[model samples]
Target: MSQNERFDNNDSDSLILSFNGDANHEFQEINENLGIVRDVIRNLVPLGAIKVAEGIVIEPVVDYVFESCKRNPNMVFVTLYYARGLQEIDHHEGDSVGPALRDMRKKRIECSELLARELVHKFNDQDLLFTKVLTKRYAFSQYDEISNRKNALDLATRLYSEMGNCGAIFLSDNEVQACVYALWSGHLVPRISRTFPILAVIDYYIPNHNLNFLENFKNLELLNIPRNQYLLDVFSYIMFLIIYTMVAANYNEIRELNGFLEGSMYLLVFSFILNDIRTLQKHGIKEFLYFRRILSLILHVILATDFALRIKHVTSFDHSIPQFHRKALSLVPIFLYWRVLLTLEAFQPIGRWLTQISRILKKSMSYYILLALAFIAFFQSFLVLENTHKRHEGDDDHLGDKNEWGIFALLVKGILNAPDFPGASKLENRFGFVLYSVYVFTVSVILFAVLLPLFMTAFATRRSVPEEYLAHFAHIVIRKVKHNQPTRYNYPSPFNLLYFTLVLPISSLSIIIGHNHIRLYANIEKFLTRIIFFIPMIGFALIETHFVNDKQDKEARDLDLRELPGLPFPEDEKQMLRRILYGLNDIKEQHRSLHFRLEAIESQLA
Candidate 1:
C-alpha cells in the first residue's frame, strides 16, 4: 500500500472501473499470459528481421561456397516458423472456440509500437555511417573477421529503425545486448539492441489493462483504480486559476487584500513540484519527458523563484530582480494556457485532443532538429560575411559582428516567423544582406515543406477507426492521470513535505518511542488534513464510491452536458432511461441463469 496507490479513506470496496470501454481477460485468467493468436504475427516481425539480415549476409557466402565446390553441393536451408496457441485446450472461452479451420481476426491495437522508428536498409558495410555504430557495437572489431557481413550491425540498426521504441530500451543492460552494438561494416558484430519479443513481454503496461492476465499462471487481477478525478480536477483547476491570478497581479495587490492567498499559492506550487519528483521516483526517465510536464515544471520553478525574489526584495529592496522575474513570468502565459488544456483533459474528448496534440509535438522533433541545423548554418555564414564592423565609424553594434551573440538569437527568431533583419537596415556589406535574404527564404521554405506534411498526418491519425482511437486515447489519459498521481508521500506536495517534517524528526529521536506514537500522529495527520482542506476532501471522498460500480466523473457533473428544456427528451428522458436500465439488468440476470443452466446440461451430456 504505497502512498501513490490510492488509499481509500472512506472504507470503500477496492474496485476497478473501466474507463469508456470494456475489456475481458477471461481467457488470460486461465492461460499463463500465453500469447493471443493475434500477437504471434507481431512477435514474429522482429524474428523476421533477424532472419532477413542473416539470409542477406549468409546466403551470399553459402552460395559462393557451393559455387567453389567441384561437384553438386548437397545443402538445404530451412526457416521454421512457430506461433503456438491453444485457446481450445486452455482458455475459458475454449468451449466455443471449435473448428480448427475457422478464421479469426486480430485485435485492432493500432500498434505504432511495432512500426520501425528509423530507416533500415542494406549498407555497403564500409560506409562511414558505421564508424560510430561499429565502435559502440563491437569491442574486438580489429580482431574479428572483416569479411563476415552476416554478423554486421547493419541489420540491428535496420531492425531498430523498424522496431523504433518497441525494442528493448533499457533492457539492453543484461550484458546480452550491450556488447552487440558494435558496427554495420563488413565484419562479425553482434546486434546492439536485442530483438525484444515485443509480444512476449506480457506486463508491458498496456493501456486497456487486463486484470485476469498474470505471470506464473496466477489468476490475479491488477487494477487501474478509479479515484474522484472530477473533484480533484475541478478543485485543482480553481486553485490553479487563483494562483495564476496572483502571479499575473505581480504578488502585490493580492497581498494587500489577503496574505493567505499569496501564501497558499506558494504551497500549491511547492506541492506540484513535490508531485513531479514523486512521479520520477515511481516511473523512471523514459525515452524523453512530456512537453506539458516540462513546461509545467518550468512554470513552477519560475513562480517559486518569484516567491523567493519577493521575500528577498522586500528585505533588501533591490529593484533589478523584478525585471528578471518579469522576464521569466512572461513565459508563464504559454505554459498556463497549456496547463488549462491539461486540466480539461479529464473529459474524454478533450483528453483525445490533448493526446493528439502531444503526439504531434512528439513526432515533430525532426522539424526542430532541421531548424537547429539551418540556424547554425545561416548564423555562421552571416558572421563570416559581415562579422567585423568598424568599432567607431561603422555599425559596431550590428548583431552579426564578431563576438556578437545576438546573431544566434536573431537566426532562431527568423525561423520562428519573427525574422529580425540585422543586416537589412544597417548592413555595411552587401554580402551580409544577400545572406540574410537567402537565410530567411531558405529556412522559411524548408520549414514549410517539412512541417506541413508532418501535421497533415496528424489529421489522418485522428481520422483512424473508432475502436483503435478509443483504446489509444483511453490509455493515454490513464497514463497521464496515473503519472500525475502522487506516490510515496500520500500527502500532496507541500503537505507531503510538511507531513514528513514531523514524522521524520520523531522517528530519528533517541528516546525510545513505540509504534503507538506513530500510529497516534498518523491518525492526527489525516484528521488535520481533513480539518484544513475540509471542502475538497469531502467532495473527493463522497465522489470516489458508487455502489452501482460502473461510475465515471467528468460528463455526469458537466453543466454543458445537462439536458435543457426543448431537448429530445423534454419529459426528462433519464427517468425513462433508468426504467430501461432496470429492465436490461433483469434481462441480464435471466440470461446469466439460463447460460449457467445450459452449461450444466451440456456438461452432463458430455
Candidate 2:
C-alpha cells in the first residue's frame, strides 16, 4: 500500500476506537496513576519531597505520562488528573514553587490538547472552535501561584497581541462556563456580568418566561416584616399609597390625617432614595439614566418638595401663600401617574407593547412634525383672513361680529369640519371661500393622507424586540426585591436609614480589612465574621430554593428532550455523532462522481 493509504487507514482506526472503545478503562488507568502520585507525595515532608521529586521518581514519571498522552487528544482526562494531582501536592507543600511549575506544565498540556483536538475533530461549528481558543488564551494568562505572576503578565501581553490580529471571539455557552468557572477560581477578576461578552449573551438569551405569582404574593405579604432593603422599599410604597388614599377621601378632616400621611410620605421618599442609591452602587451611574429611574427620581424630588410645603402650611409659617399648597396638589397627579408607569414593568407583555408603541411613534415623529406645521400655517391664515374681512365689512350692520370666529374656535372648527368652518355656507366672499376650501384640503385631507401611510408603514414594519433585554432589567429588580438578607437590618424607614448609613458601611469596611489581614485576626474573629455574612447568604439561598424551584434546570431538561441546543448542551456529544453522517454523505457523493467519470472513459475507449 501507498504511504498515504496506510496513514488514511490508521486515521480511520483511531476514529473507530475513539467512538467505540471503552473510555472507562482509560479513565480508570488515569485515576490509578493519580492515586500512586498522591500516595508517593503524602509519604514525604514538603521540603524533602520537592527536592527528591526533582532529582528522581516524581518529575520523570509525570513528564513521561504527559508526553505519552499527546498521541491521543481524547485523553484529556489524563491531563486533568495530572493537573489535579500536582495542585494537591502544591497545596500540601504550602509553597508557591510547586504550583508555579504545575501551572506552567498545565498551560502547555492545555494548549497541545486543544490544538490536537481541533485538528482531529475538525468541528464545523465556528462558535465552538472560537470559544475553545478563547478559553485556552485565558487559561494561559492565569497562573496558579503568585510567584508565576510575571509569567501571567507575559502571557497576557502575547495574548493581547494575538487577539488584535485574530479579532475578538464570539462567546458561546462553553466560553461562558469556562469564564465563570475561572472567575470563581480567582483566575479572573470580579466584574459585572455585562463586562463579559459570553455572560452578556447568556443574560440576553436566557428567557425569564416563568412568572410565579404565588411567590410574588408571598413576598408582598411579607413586605412589612423587614427582611431586606428591597422589602423595605415595597413596604414603604404600599404604606404611602394607603395613607394617600385615606387623606384623599378625608380631605375635610385634614388635621386628623396630616400626621399619618406626612410620616408615610417621609418613609416612602427615604426608601425610594435608598433603593436608588443601592442601584447606583450596583450598576453605577447608568442605572439613573434609565427612563423609569429618571422619572422616579424626579417624582421623589417633587414629593419631597410637596411634603416640605405641606409642613410649612401646617406650621402657619407659609399660610399667606396658598399657591404653595396648590403647587403641591398639582404634583399629586403626576406622582400617581409615575407610580402607575412603574407597575407596568412588573408585567412584561404590557411593557413590551408600550415599547412597541414608543418605537412606532419615534419612527413617525417627522410626519407628526409636518402635520403640526401645516395646522399652524392654516390656523394663522384663517385668523388673518377673519380679522381682515371683519375690518373690511365694518361694524355698520354688526353682522361680521356676530359671524366672527375666535382663534381657538376657528382652529377647532377647521379641524373637526364643524358647521362654523369658513368654507361652510357661513363665508360670503368668493375669494375667502376658495381660500378656506384650500386650507381645509391641505391641512386636514392632504396632511392626513401623507401621515396615514407613514403610520401604517411604521406599525407594519415593527419588529419583535428581544425579550432578553427587557427580562434582564426585570431580573435585576426581582433579584433586589427578593434578596435574602439578615432580618435585623431590614428595619422600617428610620431604622433602615440608620443601619444602611452607619452599620452597613462599617461592616463592609471591616470585612474588607479583615480579609486582607486575615492572619492578624484570631480564629474566633474570622469565624464570627464568616457567620455574619453566611447568615444572610444562607437565608437568601433557602428562600430561592423553596420559591425559585430550579426553573433554569427544568428549562434545560425540556430543551434537551426537544433536541434543542439549550444552556446545558455546552459539552454536547451529538455534534461528534453528526460528523460520521457527514463523512458518509461525502463518500457517497465522491463515489457517484467517480462512476460518472468511469462511464465516460469506457465510452471513449469503445
Candidate 3:
C-alpha cells in the first residue's frame, strides 16, 4: 500500500477528533511518535518485566518482551516504546517505517498478533494504560474502503480474554461522575457483532448489555449481546415495530386493534416504562425532577398515558377512532424508523457516514442561529408593515397561506425551494406583499448562495477525520468485550416484565423486610429469562460453548465447500446462505478488478 492509497484522514482542515477533555487526544497523538511514547512507558515501568512498543523495530519488541518475561515470570514488565522498524531501514522511502505502520494498521493481523498480546491483552484499568490501549485501538481503525470488521475484534478479543469485570476507572468510583465504562462499551461491542459471533467469544454475559446486543442483531440466530443498558433511548424501537405492524394490520378499524395486538403492545410499553423507572432511580431526584428534565418527563408521561388509555378513546367512537388519535399513533412509527438509522452506528461504514452527517449538522448550528436572527428580523419587518385593511373580501391574516398552510409555513416552503408566489400575492396586511418580495430576495440571494456554500465547506472539513469516528466505533466494541458485568438486568422485553413485576419486587421486599425470603435473584432471573426467551437464549447457550472452547473459530470462516458440515439446516436456509456467499464473492471480485484497473491506468499515465 502507498501513502496516497492509505485511509483518508480527512486532511481538509477538519481536526481528527479532538473529542473531549476526557478523551485526552494529545496523549493519544503523542503515542503516534513511537520513540517518545516508549521512553515514557519505560521510565514508569520496572525493567525486569516490561512490555514495550514505540520507535523501536517491530520484530525485536516482542522478542524483548518474551525475554523480559523469562527474566521475571511473576512480574508484568510493561514499558511503552517507539522506534523505526529495523528491517525497513534498507527499503525505499515509500516502504519506510511510516508506510509500513500504515500497512500494518490496515491489515491489522500480521504484526498485530504479538502487539495485541503485548499491549492490549495485558492492559489493566489504570488511567495511563487505558489511554495507551485506546490509542493503539485507534491505529487498528485504519483499513481499506470496504473495511475489515475483524480488525477491531483483535482488540476486543484480547480485552475480553483478560478482564471479566469493570472496576473503578481512573480511580473514580462515582457513577454519575464516572461514565468511563458506559463510554467504552456503548461505542464498540454492539457494533462488532455485525460480522463475528461476538456472543460466543466472551466468557460471561452482562445481562442488560447482552439484551441490547441481541436487540440490535434482529436475527434470532446470533444472540450474544450482553445486557446492562436500560431503555437508553427515549422510545423502545422493537416495541414500536411490533405496535406499528399491529396498527397497519388493522388500519381504519382502530377499534379492532384493541384485541391481542393491543395487549402485546401495552405489555411492551409497560416493560419500557419499568426499565426507564429503574434508570431514573439511579439518578438523584433532582436530575429529572427539576424544571429542565421535568418538562420532557411530563411530556413522556402524557404521551404514554394517552397511548395507554387509547382503547377507551377508540372503543367509544363506533367503528373508527378520533382523527387526532389515529394521527398520533401513526406519527410515532416515523420517529422509530429514524431511530433505526441512528442504531446503524453499529455498522462501520454506515456509522462513519452518520458521524460525518452529525458533525456537519452540529457545525451548522451557528448557521441556524444566524438564520433564526434573519427570521426574527424579517418577521419584525413584516410587523412594521402590518395593516388592518383587507386586500379583498374574506382576506384574513393568512391570506398568503395555501389551504392549511400558515404564513410562516408558506415562507419556509419557499425557502426550501418550493416558492408560493401566488399565495403571497393574496396577502391582506399593509405592505405584506412588498415585504414578502424583499424576504424572498434576501433568503435566496444572501442565504442560499452565500451561507449554503460555507456550510458545505464545513461539511467537507468535518468529513475528513474518518479515523476519529472509527476510534469511537472500536471503543464501543472493546468496552463490551472487556467486562462481563454479571448484574441481573439481562432480561428482554416481555421477559423483562416478569423480572420487574415478580423477581425484582420480591428482591426489593426481601431487602426491606430483612427476611431474605427470595431465592437467589440472579439464578431466578436467569431461569425466568431462559423460559421466556428460550428460542434465542437456548440457541445462544448451545452454540456459545463451542466458540468459547475453540479460540481459532473467532477468525475462522467455513469457505471450503468440501469441508463444509451439513448440520440439518432447512433446504431454504441453506440455499439463502449459498446465495449470500455468492453475492459477497461477486462484490469482492468487482472491487478487485477495479483496483487492478486503477493501478494499470496509473502506471501507464505516469
Which candidate should be chosen as best, given lDDT against the real structure?
Answer: 2
- Candidate with top TM-score is 1
Ten residues in sequence with the least summed lDDT for candidate 1: 73-82
Clashing pairs in 2: none
Q: What's the true lDDT of residue 13 in model 1?
A: 35
Each model's C-alpha lDDT?
A: 0.42, 0.45, 0.43
RMSD of each: 20.2, 22.1, 20.3
Error of 3 at 374 (Å): 2.3
Q: Candidate 2, which segments miss by more than 4 Å at Cα?
A: 1-243, 254-257, 274-287, 317-327, 343-346, 371-501, 504-542, 554-606
For residues 20-132, what per-residue lDDT tens digits would candidate 1 score against the true structure?
A: 11223322221211122124324433321322322232323323323332111111000000111211222335446543322221111111111111111111122222232
Root mean square deviation (Cα) for candidate 2:
22.1
TM-score of each: 0.51, 0.42, 0.50
- Displacement of residue 394 (Cα, Å) in model 2 is 14
